[model samples]
Target: MSMPQPERLHLDSDAATGYPNSPLPVLVYRQVLDISNAEERADAFESMFKRHGWPPAWRYHLYDFDHFHSTAHEALGIFRGQARARLGGPNGQELMLYPGDVLVLPAGVGHASLEADDDFCMVGAYPPDQKPEIERGDPAQLAAAKARVAAVALPEDSPAGGSLAELWREDS
Candidate 1:
């Protein structure tokens, strides 16, 4: 089967939220899941990420307020239900994600769950051996967050397994 092309968005820094969104664009892949069972879907997504060098995948619901990871990039794959999320800080764009959707968040990009159904669940992963440092719109961490974001290395490819290297390389 052919992979769906991802929708890309580039977010700017929000001074008020103190979020320095990445220069790398966030990539969203829609309808990527083949399994109907939530647990199975999560397992498949986690395996995919692990195969592609992203490890330590976890499954959970997203938080309902603005937050970001300053230390590492993240990939989230929706396994069940639907949700509306705000990306790129408080002033960021709101996007609706459903089961079978995948979102790739670069380091320093902000994200929060605005709303979701009771069954909402997703599988999240980071690059191999990397642990994400959570930052919640703190002005005190702005400078260091920005620096960490700027210094983060790009992933070799997309978590969904495609030509993200070229996509991200050109964007970077």
Candidate 2:
């Protein structure tokens, strides 16, 4: 079966909070995996990431408050339950994500879980050999974070599957 294409969204910086959301568009791929079992879904996601040369995939629940990663881009594959998450920044959009949903967050994009089912969980990954630095809407880190976000390179492909280079290369 062919993979479903992802929906792309580009978010701008939060002027009021100085949240440096990413210039690269966020990619949301819905129902990419057909598995219903959480463990099976997680394993599939990990394998896909590994195939794409992304490493150190981890499984966890999302944080409740808004936060951004300044050092590296991240990808999350929903393995169980459902979640309502806010992305971009404080004033950004809210998205309802379910099992089999995948989100590719560019570096410096803010994300937080507003609500979720008790069993909500996801598998997260980063580009090969890169580490993520968590920043929680810090005013002091705004300038440097924005600079780092601006300088960060795009990933070669979507964590879910398929080329993301073209989508990310477009001017936002």
Candidate 3:
């Protein structure tokens, strides 16, 4: 059988928190990820979500082609440059992603990224189930994730607005 797509949730901006938040009656664990190229991986992300029961999310990403990285459920990161992120922390951790690298934050995990790159591309993910508490990678990986964890907007801004956030917030 094909790999299942993730479930999509609705979202709203936590004007209070700056980070996007899930709507009431929804869960807050979104995912983040990356594959290779922007358009190609975006297509894959779309299909991946649909295959798993997520709403069509690709449309929310059309405007983010430069230094792009998303903060949501399991993420897909195809780095054109360096990037940073937390394994799971506030603002996530700080790390970096290198060119031609693909980072997959598969399924439900509290995560986010910072762009420490020359230029990069990535997509966020949100698996319906809670993620396993995997051990943090060694210093090398930690360093990388930190670089990938730049402030969400400085890199590419929120590609998905209220509507997309609303869709993502359903289970958050």
Candidate 4:
């Protein structure tokens, strides 16, 4: 089955708290995976992410506190259960994520899980050669994080099997 085009969400930088929310819009792909056999969904997501240059790094529920990664973009594939997450920061949008959904967050975009089902699980991945560093909404760390986020190289491929440049380029 062909994948659906992603829904993009553009967020602004939080001036007061210094959350350097990315200029690149967050991409959400709904029901992209076949979750009929829930047991194999993790493997499927892992394989897809690995094949597209985003190496699967972890399997767990999202953190309940707000945070962002300054050094790397991230891909989260929801393989089991469901969640209500806040994206962008304290003043960000609330989105409900279900199994088979994929969320692509650019570096510096804040995200946190507000609530989730008991069985909620997601597979997280990062771009090739990029390591994710957790950064809370600290004003002191904002400047350094912004610098690192700006210097992060864009990935050529997205975990969802398309040209990341085309989808993520600011000019796109």
Candidate 5:
């Protein structure tokens, strides 16, 4: 088998180029269950969503053995213990996600990680309505946002480029 390449730069908003333009593009997220006995995990997972205002309306998938790259947006959350994502090579980028830690997926982003050291669970956050795709920014930009903007929006799907549109954003 040929070696998979490590993309030094993650492609996020660029995925839109592959699809026909849309007024409102579909955004995606996921809810990961704790790694435990299947039956118990399933039950608890169901209950957790209920506590939220959610009604199990969205489509989703469960991962058991094989790691899959989602066509949909993905973020990481840990339910039980420490969870770490190992980027295939020395790409100098690895998301060190912990319990309650959230990793937002940009438009065309992909990820793969080894098994969890403890039970891992997370609820991925994405917009149901059309939203501008967003990705992690460079050091200067990230620092500036934290310093200045109460909240900054990164445009990916929206009909804008390079930055967030404050008027277009909703309450987080």
Candidate 6:
């Protein structure tokens, strides 16, 4: 089954926080999978993403401290419980993510987990051939991170199973 287009959330770079937020908007697809079993839900997400050229990388909850990836974009498929997270940076927007919600974060956008239930979990993935590097909002690394973020190539497909360029290229 095909999913609907995602909701886009745009964020700006924060000079003070040294967060080199991306020009590309974060893509949020809500309730894409309604499977009641967490393991099955995660497997479904991984299979879909792998079929679309995004390889499943890990399974975990979001980090408590704000951080970003500079080398590759990220896809987080929530399979269990719920959490409220800060996106963009420390002073950025807060969003509640529930089971079956898929969050796509472009390179350089900051994100952090504010709070979550004990069972909260997600499947993290990256585009084919793109490796992720974690970046804390450090002043000394801002310039390098910005350069890396800009140089990172766009993915050929969305983890949710569509042409990522169609959604991500318009603004890029």
Best by lDDT: 6
- Candidate 3 stretches greater than 4 Å from native: 1-37, 56-81, 90-110, 125-172
What would the per-residue lDDT of candidate 1 be over residues 44-130, giving only the tens digit for each residue? Answer: 898888877787468899999888998888999999989999999899999999998989998999999999999899999998656
Instruction: Write one digit per residue (lDDT tens) for candidate 4, span 1-172.
Output: 6878999999888867778888899999999887687669989999999999999999999999999999999999999999999998899999999989999999999999999999999999998888998888877777877888899989998898899888887864
For 5-119, candidate 5 gives per-residue lDDT tens digits of 2112332221222221111122222234435554454444444443432222222222322221222333333344455553312232355544422244433332445555545
Candidate 4 residues lying further than 4 Å off, grouped into runs, are: none
lDDT of each: 0.86, 0.85, 0.34, 0.91, 0.32, 0.91
Whole-structure CA lDDT of model 6: 0.91
Where does candidate 4 clash, by residue pair?
Answer: none
Task: Tell me how many residue pairs clash in candidate 1.
Answer: 0
Question: Candidates' TM-scores?
Answer: 0.94, 0.94, 0.32, 0.96, 0.35, 0.96
> lDDT (0-100) at residue 139 of candidate 3?
33
- Which parts of model 2 have CA positions greater than 4 angstroms off? none
lDDT agreement of model 3 with the native: 0.34
Q: Write the per-residue lDDT of candidate 2 for residues 1-172, one digit (tens) a residue.
A: 6878788888888867768997788989899899977899899988987787676368999999898988888999899999999998788899999999989899999999999999999999999756788787766768888998877767787776677787676673
Q: Could you tell which candidate, 2 or 3, scores higher by TM-score?
A: 2
Kindly report which residue stretches of model 5 are placed more than 4 angstroms away from their true locations once superposed: 1-71, 87-92, 129-172
Predicted candidate 5, C-alpha RMSD: 14.3
RMSD of each: 1.5, 1.4, 14.1, 1.1, 14.3, 1.3
The sequence of per-residue lDDT tens digits that candidate 6 reaches over residues 40-67 is 9999999988888888999999999999
Worst 10 residues of 2 by lDDT: 163-172
